[model samples]
Target: MTSPHVAALRSVALNVPDPDLAAEFYTEVWNLAVADRQDGAVYLRGTGPAHHLLALHPGEQTEIRNVTFRARSADALPVLAERTVGAGGRVLRPVAPVTEPGGGVALIIADQDGRIFRFVHGDAEHDVDTAAVPDRPVRLAHVVLNSHDVSRSQAFFERALGFTLSDRTRMMAFLRCGSDHHCVAFGDSDRDSLNHIAFLMPDLESVMRGGGRMKDAGYPVGWGPGRHGPGNNAFNYFVGPFGVVIEYTAEVLQVDDSYPTGGPEDWTWPPGRIDQWGIGQPPTPAIKEAQQAIRFMPAAAF
Candidate 1:
């Protein structure tokens, strides 16, 4: 069977201890606006056209609900459901109308490792918010997932979701559904968890300015103000409240099928450097621990 075509990474849903408090930090400090609220959940939107970039729900602790993606067409949903099952993944929910904020037909599935994913088609979108806000995020850049077996996770994305390998670093395998290098990546790890979520800043200046804003808000940069070797993106990472890791990034390299996929050897930096630029400090213990703390909510939670 052919893999379904995924258009782009859309949004992410999380169950946090305090939805109200999380909403406040995301809107006031992280620059996302409140899009809508329903069923005691607050939906947050970036400046770009996707309906909502994040959905914060009340829970006992912070855990990822699912990573969402927009399918290239509505027909891809059923195909994805079928391919997911064939690829050793389980279909938690068949294609059906989404009653949530976005209002689209969605398919929910879990990989063999139990990481949940949702694919939506014909979702609602907002008019571009072009208010000239300097440090506001335009949209989601990517989501990095930790995998005990990176190759197995990568195969699921390729055989089930039609994502292409953009590049492979020693610690991560970057995969893409569209042109922005990688919409989803898998980090080599001993557990299945969320590594981080990246928000697309308007420019390099915006990324730096965002790092300063986070520091002013009492959340210091956990890693980087540097360019990455794989995506060629400028990033500033922070460990947010409740140990949720997030990043402000810009200038992701665009590519097509013709682009060469580099291996780990091609992405190496100098001894003290973790990214393309050698200026930033290595990832902190806080961020490293936070990366492996947020795991996917159980499938029964759906």
Candidate 2:
């Protein structure tokens, strides 16, 4: 069988208390456009045609349901499922046609901390945005997860999906499936949950405009308006419902096969390692707490 490999981040699914309210926050404040809806679940897309980048489903609590990754080919899904199961990860759901709005075959697996991951192929791409002044994201950038055992989690990503480690910090790992700095990352945490989800803008101007739109909609910026040390992307963080963090980021660094990777010791720490502009206070207690918080209990089946 061919080795399974991921191509890019496809989408994120969240289980929150009120899907309608959360959907509004995403569509109105965050600027994502709805692609489809069924059975109280909403699929939202960005500027490009990659179907959707976020999915909201009904639930009493709020927490990540799954982080979805796009495979290079439909044939890759079975390979991913086989290798993941062979490597001791649990197949929360077998490979099958996704019943959700976006048509595709998806495999759901539980990572080291039992966080769900959905690897999908052959999803329908939606119509492109034609807004007069679209501020919707150019694409879904990356997802950061709080891991109970980061090393273990990182290993699974590398082994099962052929993800390359771009950089490793004492408390964070940057991994990539394609050229982008990272499509998935893990932050050291006592428990499992989402750290944040980032989406790309064409340039710094779009990032600022998007943030301004969010702020005008009553979602104040929680952090950023600065560049980061690793990917060197400009960022603006806003807290969404159920304390889910969303970032409007632009101009992320890219790498090819020849680019060298680094570990914590090799990184340039301090002097705005997290924030190159040296702006904004350090992460607040709420931010720290949210990193490890479990906002929703995963359903027994996918």
Candidate whose TM-score is highest: 1
Candidate 2 lDDT score relative to the true structure = 0.80
TM-score of each model, in listed order: 0.98, 0.93
| Residues 65-169, model 1: lDDT tens digits | 999999989988989999999999999999999999889899999999888999999899999987859899999999999999999999999999988898998
Candidate 2 residue-pair clash tally: 1
- For model 2, the superposed segments whose C-alpha errors exceed 4 Å read 1-4, 130-134, 271-273, 299-301
lDDT of 1 at 38: 96
lDDT by candidate, in order shown: 0.91, 0.80
